[model samples]
Target: MTKPLPPRNDRHKSSGGFSLIELMIAITLGLMIMTGLVTIFVKNSQARTEIERNNRQLESGRYAMNLLTEDLRMAGYFSSFNPDELVISVNAPPLGPNSAPVTPAMTARPDPCDTTVANLNNTYFFHVQGYDYPYTSAALPTCISDVRTGSDVLVIRRLATCVAGPTLEAGCDALPNGAPYFQASNCFQATELARNTGSRLDYLSHFVLNTDITLATLRTISCLTSFGAPAPAADYRRYLTHIYFVANNNVGSDGIPTLKRAELGAGGYTIVPLVEGIETIQFEYGIGNTANSAKIDAYTADPNTYNACASTACLLNWLHTYSVKVNLLARNVEQSPGWTDNKVYALGLKADGSANVFPASGTYGDRYKRHAYNAVVRLDNPSGRVTP
Candidate 1:
């Protein structure tokens, strides 16, 4: 009657939970998959970081190059006449009784050929000058910050291309006859006049009256007519002074080198940061022999060579400059861990035609990545007028 107890239920016993060994194998496989996924994620992150760093460096370098190229091409540009032939006529304030009719003091325009006129000590006229690497503030007064040791300084002087209409409100001020006021289409704003009171009258020589406007009605001095009948607003321009240099740091003590510009603004000279991560800058001038051929005859790093007094044979060489070769050393924003830069980069030829190399030691041995950029910007204003 016990009836074979219940034929043993073997099926239920076999279908119980998994064994310890099986659980261990499943866990091991899951851990292996997770390890692979983590490795891939880390590698992708590193790649993205590297790409971003490179792009940033490139963008900064390109911007700096473009800015300099535009300015260099326009160097020495006046509205429609050669600046060399122009002379600034400064009027002496009307004095006691009859002060000899105050024959306006006539001084030649800033000429690279004249040392006394082109000297920075004058400060009234715009002059183009440069200082090679390792120069001191004493040598370059416009360099306010501590510059990078081996970086060059470039000074550009020119007139702005923008023109103002002959409207009175556009900086034109009316004065009584013989009162001695600047007669130009555009007058400096109140702020500009206040900031540049010392040289305000001298800079007026940069402007000429509209040909249609009679010079007799404007109380203009003979200097205006010496150049030729003044042209209209379409031919007028404003003076511009720019100084370029590399600063030791960008923000605070971060050690991020930057390209800076000190421009003559409405409020006088203002220093502005243009591009960051530019560790160094160098420049070479291509002097052309206009008397013989229009092609470049020689290259020099010293702007003084173009100075009339610096080299008697090369006097007026600045006017013959056809091209400017620029070299910039660009660097990454962040340091690469465990990386060392051990290569010397050649920028260009020195003043004496010798190879100019960065880190003369043959190795920088730093964590930051660097690149050298070379560009030859033709000075259209100077070269186009060269006579073969």
Candidate 2:
């Protein structure tokens, strides 16, 4: 009876479901919110990828810069032998039977991969050398098979800081028999004993620089060769020759510009990849004005002024290099999204007071982000031995 009374207000009834207009508006709002969320997700993902690439690029560039800079400081370390000792013999006039050896004609650059004993003997005077934009007539050794075009190559020669063998130190392993070993004479030979007028460094023939150690009769610090008793065998060190350059590929033509090191070993020159994404390496040499200068008087991009270096003079020019400016152009391994490397980046300094830019042109028209790392490293081993 109560429900029959309420049926009289049926014209004022409330709706129990959404109308078509309200449903359409609700669906449109839902789609807009989903689209915004998707856009945010995409932007975040891209931002994350860009951050990773930048971090990797930064690591590679700084590591390379530090490596080159630190190694450059250790360029001419040969245990007890200094370039100062070499300077006296090669420059002074012939004194006697144990005087300066006959020097060869000057070549602008020596082959970094030349492991032949003869070649080693000839170029041992130049402990450090660099080649700028090597190609055609200025090509490096054939051992360097993948040198990137328009990049510089650096050669560093030194001895192991620790002792090497015949006998082994606690940390270092003995070098194989055929590998080149060096033993400089702190104690002189019988020929040098007769003419005690000069120092041990006076004779150029006393050092064991070549691989042929059969007649390497140089002695240790102990001058124990009493008339008949044999002198103690010298503790020789592993002669290290490293050539650093930018190679076109890392492994099997990957197209990743890598900093490759061709290190001299028992077998010969062995190539190995170091830091990757190092697109270009350029060096500016800080040349000292005098033979014994410990400071940089002038800087030159090209040390191979062929006309300037003649015979022993050539050795002097390279020996006088007191410092090196290392410039490395490093880039991201992958292309950045919505990015263009149209900006000109300066690495080193130019003669006209501007910065030295890469690609040899105005800018790099590419998508990869790049950064330049540079450091001026002093040649401590060589420059320290000289008076400022």
Candidate with maximal TM-score: 2
Q: Write the per-residue lDDT of candidate 2 for residues 236-308, one digit (tens) a residue.
A: 8888888899999988989999998988987698898899999999888887756555778877665666335
TM-score of each: 0.70, 0.82
Model 2 lDDT on a 0 to 1 scale: 0.75
lDDT string, candidate 1, 31-99, tens digits: 999999999998899889888888989898888989988998888665454333322111231111223
Each prediction's Cα lDDT score?
A: 0.60, 0.75
**Weakest 10 consecutive residues, lDDT, candidate 2?**
93-102
Candidate 1 — worst ten consecutive residues by lDDT sum?
88-97
TM-score of 1: 0.70
- Counting only residues 3 or more apart in sequence or on different chains, how many pairs clash (N, Cα, C under 3 Å) in candidate 1? 0
